[model samples]
Target: DLDDPARVLRSNPETYFKSPEEMYRLFPGREEAVERTLEIAEKCALILQDTGVHLPGFPIPELYRNADEYLERLVMEGLRERIPGAGEDVFTRAHYELDVIKRMKFSGYFLVVWDIVHAAKERGIPVGPGRGSAAGSLVCYALGITSINPMENGLLFERLLNPERVSMPDIDVDFCDERRQEVIEYVIDKYGKDNVCQIITFGRMAARAVVRDVGRVLKIPYGDVDKLAKMIPGPGVTLSKALSTVPELKERYEQDPNVRKLIDLSLSLEGLARHASTHAAGIVITPTRLLDHVPLYRTNKGEVTTQYEMKILEEIGILKIDILGLKTLSHVDKTLRLVAEHEGIDIAMEEIPLDDPKTFELLQKGQTIAVFQLESAGMRDLLKKIAPTTFGDVTAVNALYRPGPLGSDMVSDFIERKHGRKRISYEHPKLEPILRETYGVILYQEQVMQIANDLAGFTLGQADILRRAMGKKKAAVMEKQRERFIEGAVGNGIPKKKARTIFDLMAFFSGYGFNKSHSAAYAMVSMQTAYLKAHHPQAFMAAALTSDMSDTNRLVVLIDECRSLGIVLHAPDINSGGVEFGLSNGEITYGLAAIKNVGVQAVRSIVERREEGGPFKSLFDLCDRIDLRLVNRRVIENLIQSGALDSLPGNRAQKMATLERILTEAQKRQGARDRGQTFLDLLGSAGVSGEIPLEDVPEWDESLRLHKEKESLGFY
Candidate 1:
């Protein structure tokens, strides 16, 4: 009965549900099985042990006694290199951070992160300047784990690690996407493979997805189901909440019996595990075999992963780091390599002047097609409207161009004050310096903390607490902090009215304020990409095209951008271009591998043949010079249609017309050559000089030519 499809389809939460007692009646033997299971469960006892942190220790040299000592030595060395002749205040800040880190038992964590970044640098992999709140740590800066100087950037250390609220420091590292796996492999080698595994995540059915899924299982029409699903608003809206909030949906549920049935079934299935997969960036490394602590499961792809998800693993004292793969890093690295290869100049990302006028000019004009972060449509509009001339403005733009800021007058006010259309003023004189960079707009959460510290006389840590309390909107906590802030302000000679006003403003803006550390770090990346585009347009665009080679829509946009930049892109040339799009003679060349149906191996064979011998004189020359096994008729047809063979001979129509005969002749000539027969011996002539001419044919019409080009190359 359970195996019957009709009964399965008939089952629903409203009318056809089974009780536990009915299950015993449905299958009489089940009661004995249940009793036996409960007896075994009663015999078994489980205890939840408080396992301490299981982070793998960083190996230090004999000269250093512990990870803390080694971290100090490395910080001292990096301090000299990063900031020469550091002042007493810098030393004092560094020592304070180091002391806090040592006391918190996170020296090993910092050293481990430093080692990963160091390995990335040594191997020439592109890592982001910084990510998340970790950028606020001077210790991170000195160790070269992060590039931003917290003191200069006004980033607060408390935001990263509040000494009062102790938790594990999480530092998510981003690497060039193309080479991110290499770093993960390195970690696996250092820590035994048994101790390292990726974390698993479950994908739950949400409101819209559950609607469609239940509809499909019930054999409802896709269009009707899709319309019903679209009525549920966006992600994270539960079906129950949607039915209550959406008037149309509730009316339909009351009026349409089928709609109510579908939705009711969907609600039962909602939030259940739809599938399980590996986490994209989370990988755990333990001090011993991972299975000894956490149970492991093998994914369908044959990857061993933890049964517990990231949060569960964290709760059980396992260390998980997000080794995020960012494609923008790959684009930057490739652009730098292209710059060096094409024009004999060495360009380092760190050495690129952040204050380059040309870079800002390009950004201000909104020419950020391939620029990181600023390439979005809204960001581009923001850039053009703001016309940012400083790197600080770029960072502020990054922080402000979000849903919270855009939905309110925050972005408009920021723009107006930036252009002086609106006056920039603070409630109190002490708020000016803290909000000056943002034109008196509280654009960053760090600014909120700073304002609290400067005006209310709270320590940075206590200020962090106020920021959190305001962000979480806990009435009790907010009242207590308000009292503390007003009392502290009165003690510091500030009027209570002014202090209350500032606190209210902070509370209102705290919800919209962004992380300055993350904004500055990503803005630095955006600047690096913009700098390359300004100085090395051809190389940068070529690299951008190569990175997005597989994405047709992006390729079309990039090609248009190349045209706007006044860079002429020649058609793919069999003799010149390799598998990737590249720069040649101050112009971009189309990559042969970008064409549809043309494999990389086929491109490699064509390039190898052209490099070994001279350039192919004609279409026949191309077929005769290369093996037809890899570059078969389909490959040849694609190349001609894609314009890769345009330089070799007759027009696309003519080459395609005579392709079959040319391939036959080339195969015969190969057979003759294998028998040690020269052209003279095989054909009784000294050499075969020219291509065989088929009946005279006109070139493809302009419209047809462009259509074919778009078909094969993804763009005309």
Candidate 2:
């Protein structure tokens, strides 16, 4: 009977909890096993209550006796490096998670996260310091998994993981978006490529999409289908909700057989998986070749993917790593390279000082553009009034500049407090240090954790547990924690009612506390770019424009940034423009590669040929010296239309007329040279053909020329 019950628990592996009676029936009178089953169920219940409010998490499997003691041993065992003091002895919420992890046998998961993130750092890929509840972990900061000291930030580890609330840590790492692929490749190389693969996501038939698909398949009138699809409410509500609002649809379902079929089928099919695509940032690594544990499929690009979803992989103990590309890192790298070439400066972009007053002054002016994650117009407006003066301000503003805070009077309060116009009140004197930097407000998860430990005589690990109860919004657990906290505070000579009030306040905001580690990590990038914009506007803007060359709208915004900085941006110039934007004589040089129809390789070829045999004197000289096979007549026409060939043109129409003749002659000359013919000697003996007017085509008007240029080069 006990065996049957145990089998049932195993069958329901997806759910996190089981009943004591169920466990007893499965153990068949084995007292020790039966006892363990109750222990497991109790642990699962404590964590599941956490999920109902906010944390939807699965419990870690049990390994040894005594959760905290087991965690200590796991900590000792899972040190990836054997250096002295590479131990998890720190106080904070992170510590609590580590302790719980050891007892729960989830130390391997932390080690796996550490290893991948370490590799990223080694490669100088900017991994995010921490995100979500992970920032509350002191262990993460100690492990260098995060850079912001949670001890200083006052983060609660229990918010990340708790003895009572056992769940896998949802840790996301950020790398420079451009360099993110390099880290993924490294993982593939370390773990067997077959054993590592990104997670697969399914695209569902959303309300409008389902209706459209049904309409197409049913051969309904196209206009009718489009109108009906548009009539479906969007932004949040789905087709099912749309049908209720549009009584006409209801009437059609009742009155028309085909419309009824359409509506009914669409309702059933909405949200069903329509196609499978690999997760953009999620990847899982297995101990052995992935195929040994899970079935795999190949993407269109021939990349392997596990048949198991992200959760399924975790259930089986496969490690999941999110290798997110930050795109901003790519911009940084490109900017550095441009600076090296154009300014002859070996400016170590990563080594830029974090505390630059001038940079903050510019930020205070609300002059941010082409800055990672901080260029929104609304954000600019916030910065103008806030007048942030320190690295802390950047972090605070970044965290507070989101939706809820924007809607509330939070922005004005934060600004006034930071500038000293408003008094910073901690509500209690002992909590002053923790609240001082953030203007007497608990804006980070770490702060809540630190406050719990400081005032309540709780250990850092226990504080983390309290943090979780608060963050989860579990009313029962929160109520219990509140009573215990008040009792502790009263024991420590604080009023019981005041303690209760503060605990309630922590509960209100802990759910909203931004991770200081993540905010600081991102703020570092935003500031570095800001610094560059402050001092090296031309080079920074050139790189920003180059990175966004393919996107006219973004390029347009960056062009505006360049103008505000008083840096001139020249249009594409065949003679002076390099492959991408670069600074020259205090101005942003146009990128020939950005010119539409001009591929990088083709432009590169032209540049290499020019470098090898000196610059061209004219159209004839260009045709004679360069291989025009790659930059054929059409490419030439585009170049002229974009005014890239303005150095040789009467106007676009004249150059367009003569482009075919130039390419044909270049091809003939190349063919002769391949056939062992001496074109230079023949031309010299016959005397160079000159003085003849070569197709004096009419010149295009300025607007016509610009339009053609825009069409060819993808400019607007």
Candidate 3:
């Protein structure tokens, strides 16, 4: 019956809608088969075993005896370079973190991350300053795994790695999206290829999706399916919930037989795994060949992956690292390269002053079109309201612009307090120091940890646990934590009622508090992009345009931004344009590949031909010198229509008219050359040297010219 669709449908009266006699006739043996199958299933049972952590071993140099010694040596050496004038606090923190890492048996994990990140940096691939709670480690900073200084940022290492809680340290590394593959390949090479594989993820059919999918398979009308699907509200909403809460949906289900059948099928199908896909950033590295432990599968594209998902893989002792590809890293990389190439200044990203006045001015004016994490409309409006003046303001804005804080009155309160429209107050005087940087609003998870430590005398590790309990909102765990927090605060000489109130505030805010380390790291990228825009507008825009070249709508918006910035965007030129939008003489030149139907190989051939022999003197010259196979007739037509051939000796219309003659002559010349004809023979070919008369026509009107441009370039 489970395998028979007809029998399954016959079992559901709403689905079959048959009379009792017809139903019994159709499902004659269904009851006997179901009973037999249940009797057999009761005989089959299995128990799964839990295997402990299987962390991959890090390869260490023979000079070091073990991974621990190598990690310590690297951290100390990196500390010398990261902080030349090392003080007692720096050394003390580094040693303390090293102790905790060694105690937790995470020395090898740290070593592995440092090695991968170091290789990326050595190869000049742009790596983010840091990501997630990993930035809250002084060891990560010193080892060059993360760039954010935890001490200066007031980030606690225990928040990242709790001594009281034993778990795998998660260090998610971000690389430039363009070069992320290269970093992955490097890791695959360092670790044996067979030992590493991307983890598999399953996509489930959520409530609304299942409804529409079942409706289509059931051959229902499109309008009805869409109407039913719309009735399911919110993310992850179930059909049962929708039927109970939505009056209209309930009415339709109760009254319409078809609606009832659809809802029943959707409820049965929802939350079932529909498809398998590779997790974007989850890659697991095993100590030995991967197949020895976990079963493996091949994706449709032939990439090896584990059959187990991330949670199962971790439960069985595999190390999974999130190697995220961030587009902003690519933007920063391209902007820096452009700055060095055009302005003759090689600016180190780390050395740029974080307090640049012009960057703050740009942020204050809300002109952040391409700034990382700050380009959204809501963030821009928040920027205008707050008028940020310092790096801290930028970090605060990044944290507070999210849904939870924004949906509540927290965002408005933060803005008002920062602007002095509202007074900053704290429930307890001890909370003043903790919330001073955020203008007395609980904006970061780190503040929650700080409040627990200062007021309640809980250690940072226990505070992190409290923060987690609040975030998860586990009833039993939260209740236990609440009691402990109140007791601890009372022991520190605070009134019990005041302690309870503070704990409640902490619990409420912890639900939505942003990770301070992550905010600071992301804010650094935002600030870098903003600084480049303020100091080098043309370079920044050109890079930004190149990054989003494939998105036509985005291109239009960026082009408008370019115009507003008083930066001129020149049309594509065969003689000058590269494969990507580039800055030339303070103007942005459209890339040849940005035009429709023009591929990268074609552009490369054109650019190489131009470089080998100087710029094409005419249309005939371009055809004669370049390989026709790559830049064929169709490509030439696009180039001309998109105005890339504007620098040649004719108007677009004239060039269009003369294209056939030019191609015929060039083809004849190319064939002769291919046949080993002498240079004289090629020059003596018919119509090769003489001027080909074109059908003279008036130049296209501005509207027509722009129309052609839009058709070929996807934007005018």
Candidate 4:
């Protein structure tokens, strides 16, 4: 046993650091053991290699020769559907993208994503328009993997997959939050469940967090530790950097022994793994048993996940995808459902017009309360200033509202140019077409690539590499790219000095270049939500309220938004209120499920019994007909307080007075029914038609009623 001190030799135990000489001096006879340990260490070292991606083949129908053929057929069919009387440029772009995808051997990957999206759509699940650079692929657009047409938006396929730099192309899809699992399960069933698993994530200890942890373990005062931690400046600041920048922390560390010890220990333990958990969106699908490639980890809740995180899986060339569940899609789905049910008009998200005058009017007013991505206060302010008119303007606004653009004069300059207050000139006449969309702002990464391709005689793939070099600011790579760009530009009839100037301007703006593909997709969602809110405020606000019914703070904001939109919200009605907030007769009815202490089970029991028989005529009729086990005394009290029972004959105070007797009698009936005894019906029929007398109690005053209502429901 090497661990046995008596059997093995070790350097001085008190010392944390020991030289090789100290080890040999401690045990002259164990020199062979030390050499053997180093030999084993060399053998045990692991170097991860880039073993190219191992994606499983997507199964196409037998009529197709391979994935590429099937994908092409589907793309052509979809293109006809997406664009009636498609132009030559659309066909050329589609062919170019298909060729690139086939060459990259990514046909299977695209088909896999297409299949998932197909399943979601066929099942009536709302999927996002697109996300990330994948939206730039015309093939993705044609295949219905993305709803945004790349050709129409000037998105570059090279941005999604650079042929010059061969890396895995990521396609993250968002589905309705309520049904995201259905898609995941479909994947698991197609690929064996054992071969598919989510990725693990590690939460690392930052400087402040590490200091607090070490201090807590060392039994320091919480206030002292908190003060010291706060003095470390912002997050990710190490103790060494903090000491150099923060004078008080440095002074205390030098003058106090406890502070010195805490800092010393924290420095050693910082950046270590604090905990391991599942990544929120990443899922890894392997070609074979998952354990054959990576170790499997079982979470505390028994969910199987890969021990390696997303980056590690990517580095090792595994097929990892992100299936994001966005609540906005859920809200959109619910809104569309409500519109169809009440107004008999079915609204397809894809069919919503981008140039709806009412939608633009709403966007101009900065009245987006629950609209996706444009609800933030700063975004709202930007919307009012920009007063976007076109879909492209909305996309540009989404891209320009980021910190890098907002912190500079780019946003203001673009605004001025768009409003005709400032001159919009390009670096060269040739650059006009590329930068014309954003008023010569160069607001997208794709624009940076386009300039290189058009002005410098670079291929789209090479242009993508040039864009990456500029974005990363890699000094050596940028120098080479600059020389090539200058030579190419000069040969193409541009002066060398002007070419250099254009390159420099691009480098400066590249840092603020947002992904136009992502912006366009996000704008699509924003327009969809805005369309619903613009035309159907009552149904949309009701759906928005239902989406956030569980969050009290968000509910308050949505309620206020409802009021601002002139949408009246009624109290929950005992007979008509459903589990979710419902639109009833042109008004919003509060959901029974939103009321505190009334669980989904209680709401289901109430709604089912009402639909089965008829409206509850009295409290006894409701309690006696519905299953009382789910709707207990606390649930009944909450219902009474929330005014769901207001439609009945009793007031809030009267309902509360007789709640116990009703529940006791209802429980007796439920227990008798459960035991298969129908003898209770002989006593009397407690059906909806029969009215039960209530204990005569005065109605609660307005103040008390409102207070109790506010307590039962998050808002009055």
- Among these predictions, the greatest lDDT belongs to 4
lDDT of each: 0.87, 0.72, 0.88, 0.89
lDDT of 3: 0.88
lDDT tens digits, residues 1-716, model 1? 53234674645664765666776787787788755756897889878788667788678899989998999988888888899988988889888899889888888888878888889889988988889998899999998888878888787788778887777788888899999999999889888899888999999999999888877877889999999889988877899999999999999999998888888888888999999999999999888899778999998899999999888887777888899999999998888888999999999888888899999999999999999989988889999999998888999999988889999999999899989999999898888898898999999999988887888788888888888899899999999999999998888889999888888999999999998989998888999999999999999999999899888899899999999999988888887888988988999988888888888899899999988998988888889889888888999888888888877657999988898888888888877888998667656232356356654689999999999888888777
Best by TM-score: 3
The collision pairs in model 1 are none
For residues 142-230, what per-residue lDDT tens digits would candidate 3 score against the true structure? 88888878888878898678988888888999999999999899989988899998999999999999998988888889899999899
**Using alpha carbons, what is the TM-score of model 2?**
0.77
In angstroms, give how far residue 248 of model 4 lies from its true place: 4.3
Q: Candidate 2: where are CA atoms >4 Å away?
A: 1-166, 169-171, 207-270, 342-344, 420-423, 456-474, 680-693, 713-716
- Which of the predicted structures, 2 or 3, would earn the higher TM-score when compared with the native? 3
Cα lDDT tens digits, model 2, 385-467, are 88778878888888888766667666777778888899888767878987888888777777787778788877666776776
Q: CA RMSD for every model? A: 4.8, 11.9, 6.5, 5.8
By TM-score, is 3 or 4 better?
A: 3
Ranking by lDDT: 4, 3, 1, 2
TM for candidate 3 is: 0.92
Clashing pairs in 4: none
lDDT of 1 at 99: 89
Which rank order by TM-score, best down to worst? Answer: 3, 1, 4, 2
